[model samples]
Target: MSKPSYSKGLVGVIAGESAICTVGTGQGLNYRGYNVNDLAEHSTFEEVSHLLLYGHLPNKRQLEQYIRRLANFRQLSTAMRAVLEQLPGSSHPMDIMRTAASVMGSFEPEDENPNNEKQRNNQWECGDRLIAIFGPALLYWYQYHKNGTKIETRTGPNDTVAQNFVKLLLQTDNPDPNMVRAVDVSLILYAEHDFAASTFGAIVTTSTLSDVYSSVCTAIGTLRGPLHGGANEAAYRLISQFKTPDEAEQGLLKLLKEKKIVMGFGHRVYRKGDPRSPIVRDWARKLSEIINTPYAKNLYAVAERMEQVMMREKKMFTNLDFYASIVYHFCHIPTDFFTPVFVIARTSGWVSHIIEQRQDNKLMRPISIYTGPDPAKTPYVPIDKRLERSKL
Candidate 1:
């Protein structure tokens, strides 16, 4: 037998590759057989989510009913809103999202019904709870501090999450359809990737037969780090530090000389190009035209130019985070709230992966290659002359 092997990330383990379609590959992503692109282009977020959890895209009639169910679910219970209000406005966006997810669990915990419709139904409710409450949880805390007014997210039209979110957040019934479309496709594109670290963390939690809420909570905590979903927020912050392409290029050269990463430049996957980049870049370009901000236009140009320089200097292309930063900014996402918005879109992908992992379950436990001393003998110290561990 071969000697036991150890790898830190299990990065290429191919834990389970779905026959599901993909986008970076030119084909649209389908959960089992239905396309998420088709759903985003033609169907509602509710319908797409239902397809993932239920194993088939809904028919027209089924979709209609699904939309109504999601509409009802959009209203966060009074307690959830209250919880959001209690959180300090200064809390990290991920902290706020994870707290909302964990506390909402107390309001709607999944029932124990393995491999059955009831379990699926409960998971759907939990899914609805997340999609529904995210904006409210985010905005309630945001507006309360920014404008000192209590905001309500229950007030959007019966339509797509993208459309409804724009309407609710902007407090306008008439939002540009193209803007909504941009948001919809962004959700679709980020919806799933094969076992990113955060997805694996969700799988590990759910693999324990933990409730759906627990799994989601665990996933959000992991995603809050800079190496994962939080990278977009870091990317925006990095871009904002430079006022012009020349400045950014100079700063990046300095960082490279010091052997530091320029956030949003490289990816753990996609060696040559990230397929998702062009899609979001188009959206960012369109939104720059629509929002008509000089900074927005300048920022986009600077980022693209920087990407070109990095390719020449460091041989790295812009990844999803690069374009996602500018697009999300033009979408009215505050720099600090970038990752929270990511949590909103990525919840669909995260939960779907969690469900899929449990269906064909395995413990994700991995061995570590230890390099420390095998075992140092403990030395005795006088109790009367005790020293603190830090001092020692």
Candidate 2:
């Protein structure tokens, strides 16, 4: 062989196929052939989730039933609640999600036989149940630790997923309608991305015919990495450090001059620009208007200045996380919970990929180029005979 080629990080490599989402076409993102911008503008998170999971946008009747089904599945079992209460308060929310997911699987597992259709239906139900209750599970733990009380997680049947999440997190039944809409849009935008690192990790797990919860847990752990799903929290911390756009501009410029890494400006895909950024930026602006606070307006201005500076200086574009930070902040969500929120939205994509992987399953093993010395040339030494050639 002349040489074995490898793409580090699998950059621009086609590791597998997916019918769920298309990314970086320079046109925009699409979930199951529908444009993400359209979905974000016109569809609820539940609807987009249905599209991703079941492979089509539901009609009025279907959507009504789908929303009802998701609402019905939103309650956590007593065992699950007990498990959440036992986790340490200092644990990262992502870890909480990973543990919660694994715990849920233990409570309700798929059928043991892989060849049975019941197993597939069980997996699908598990996917829905997890997505439906993730917010409740996370918020229950959050409130128990923060307030020393167990907050009721079920808001009402009338509440949407985004609305319920905001309500439960803030411990209020009533929230700003505009904020609710902004959150719904954000969830839709984050719902699916084709073969994102976490999604790929889920696919790998599912390819081994593992349970859906195991796949989701694997994706959660993968997303917990700073490089992957934690960018929004990092971006929020950066923008929140400034008092005004001028201070933000100066601080950003200083960091840029010092060649420090910025977390949320660029993306691995979407070289021209992230198509989702503009849509989310608009929502962020609308949220800023709705909140109409000095801090909200200042933060929005800071984010804009950062975007402009990064583009002008680095020729980089704002990714979804940049504007998402502003939207989540205006909604009063904690920065630490940002990545966990990502896991909530992205569970749809993860479970969808898991189902897809199992439909045409194959182990995701890839070959590596060997660089070590030949085994024959290396002799194993017995513990008694081994001795150091030199002593320090």
Candidate 3:
């Protein structure tokens, strides 16, 4: 008999089909058939979230009602706030998001009946509720730790998620419109990608018929890895080490000589380039000009030089995280909070995947090729009879 072909890391494996997104073999990303670029240019994150979770983009009245629903979901319960308080002040913001989602499930558990329409609607509601609260919970925990003040999470009722996030982070009622728009665009860009590591994790959990919160928790844990969602934070640290474009080029060349892994230069998919990178790069440039601090101005130049060097040297392109770090810095977001913001944006897509998996539930159990000693040749050994590697 012929041995089946094996692909490491599941590369080129067709795990399953998803109607939620198109990536990896596309001109650009699409969420439910809407081009990501068009959504970034013309749609709010709320509208995009609605489009992803509820199928079609909401009409004006429908959008109004949806926003109102999200606004109501923003306030954290006393128990939820207490959980945040108990978490160490030094905890990573991603940890806070994970804990917040778990606590939310305890409060508003997913309905038990997967086959019922109301239960499905309940899952949808949970997704929205998560989107509404992630930023608030993160900011509330942030303010408490940074200032020793238990800040209010609820802001203006009409505020979009981006506006609410800025309001909470800056502790101001009126956030800069440009900053809000930048964040909104970033959220839209980050909202979904087909079968990303974290999204796949969510699907795997849901395939087992796990609850929505479990699936989201699984996704969050997967995204917390540095190679995955931490790229933006890593990219920022890399760029900030240099003061000028020339310095950046020299530094990068040296790092490349050492074979150091650049954090935000390439993608596993997207051979041409990340479509989202340039959009966020434009935002970074615009914000840099507006802010015009010495560091802010220098940052963009250094980043561009780095991009040029990478492409010229290695034929790699900048992914979204490279310029996104600059945009967040100009907006005054703390470096450590970068991945948490990713969690906030990505929760929409994670929940969507969870719901989609539940609709046609199947346990995800893939077989791995055996590489260890053959079972027939290596029978189970008694504890006292097993030889140590040194003896072997």
Candidate 4:
């Protein structure tokens, strides 16, 4: 009866409402009304996860109890360990994360509750369990397949998520305090962004009344794409190719001339700039200074040169992933494991969105304006009479 309006990629579409985190809100990013700067400056990953899950920052006693609870949940079940052992080292780490989330769901199944009350509560616990165990699960697979070491998942009862992750990955009881803080701040910064691609994917799955694990698995799959969570890995690969800042400038200039799309340079929502970038960029610089190796120093320089070139050429600013790769590099993390780290941190946000979706249930179905052959002209033909279309 009337021409239907269409917005490609759903750009500028208000898909839903959320109060979880605000991006480009003039005062900078906030989680549950707390500024990201304050959270990054002062809060641990455990505290931020608590804020995302329980809707408030924890007091000292509450934080201690929460930490203990998460610690207690860190141990993987026998089946989980077996599954991790079977996964080959050739598998992508993000695939490992996806498989681990699905496997955890099987071992700890959520009962289907029509009322959703029991299921919702179970999801909260499931979220906490996954947050606690994801690092252990991932590193266990990594070490076992890499060199036949069945690494322990639990580093300490009191260790924060960042500490446990670093300790386990590095296989050291004593990790660099600066490295630990960098990881902690990265986790906080990456913990949530309102309706990001992966979060929205999780929300879409949740709208179908799926289990929390399935929803998180959906999120993981969505994040595995290069345009989303994989950007850091790609960005790191780009930075690693250059040995000097001047070389980096020339290489990046060539890339721009070739009309290549650089990863981790801009954002869809933050036209002004990504606030999260500078915070992690500072960490990258700090860690580079501490590492002081030629590679570390050179990588930081190359990254900075690339940032400057991107800004000068396209007026685009670096997003969180560009410099995050540098931070992870200084921490001795493998390039491929970069996005898996993203999964571990963003699990808190995924679970929060799942919980919120359950609170306000909807099918999330949107109509599309179809463009096809007219039904009257292209009536259903009998199979015997159908003609094959010509190749383009």
lDDT of each: 0.73, 0.87, 0.90, 0.90
lDDT of 2 at 20: 87
TM for candidate 3 is 0.96
Model 3 misplacement above 4 A: 1-3, 114-121, 386-392
Candidate 1, 9-48: lDDT as tens digits:
6655666665433534444345556655455556556666
Residue 390, model 3, lDDT = 71
Winner on lDDT between 1 and 2 is 2
Task: Give lDDT tens digits, candidate 2, residues 1-392.
Answer: 67688898999899877888889876578988999888888889989988888889999998888888888887888999899999999998988999889888898886556465224767778888889889989999999999998887777776788988999887787888888898898899899999999999998888777888888988998998878899999989998898888898899889989999887888898888898999999999988887788877878998999898889889999999989988998888999888988988999889888888877777899888898888999899899998778874
Question: Candidate 4 residues 93-174, lDDT tens each?
Answer: 9889999889988888876777654245477899999898889999999899887998779878999998998998899999
Model 2's number of clashes is 0
Whichever of 1 and 3 has more TM-score, that candidate is 3
Error of 2 at 384 (Å): 2.7
- What's the C-alpha lDDT at position 167 in model 3? 93
- Residue range 312-380, candidate 3, lDDT tens digits: 999999999999999998888999999989988998899888888776677899998766787788778
Which stretches of model 2 miss by more than 4 angstroms? 1-3, 116-119, 388-392
TM-score of 1: 0.87
Per-candidate alpha-carbon RMSD to the true structure = 3.4, 2.1, 1.9, 1.7
Query: TM-scores of all models?
Result: 0.87, 0.96, 0.96, 0.96
Location of the lowest summed lDDT over 10 successive residues in candidate 2: 110-119
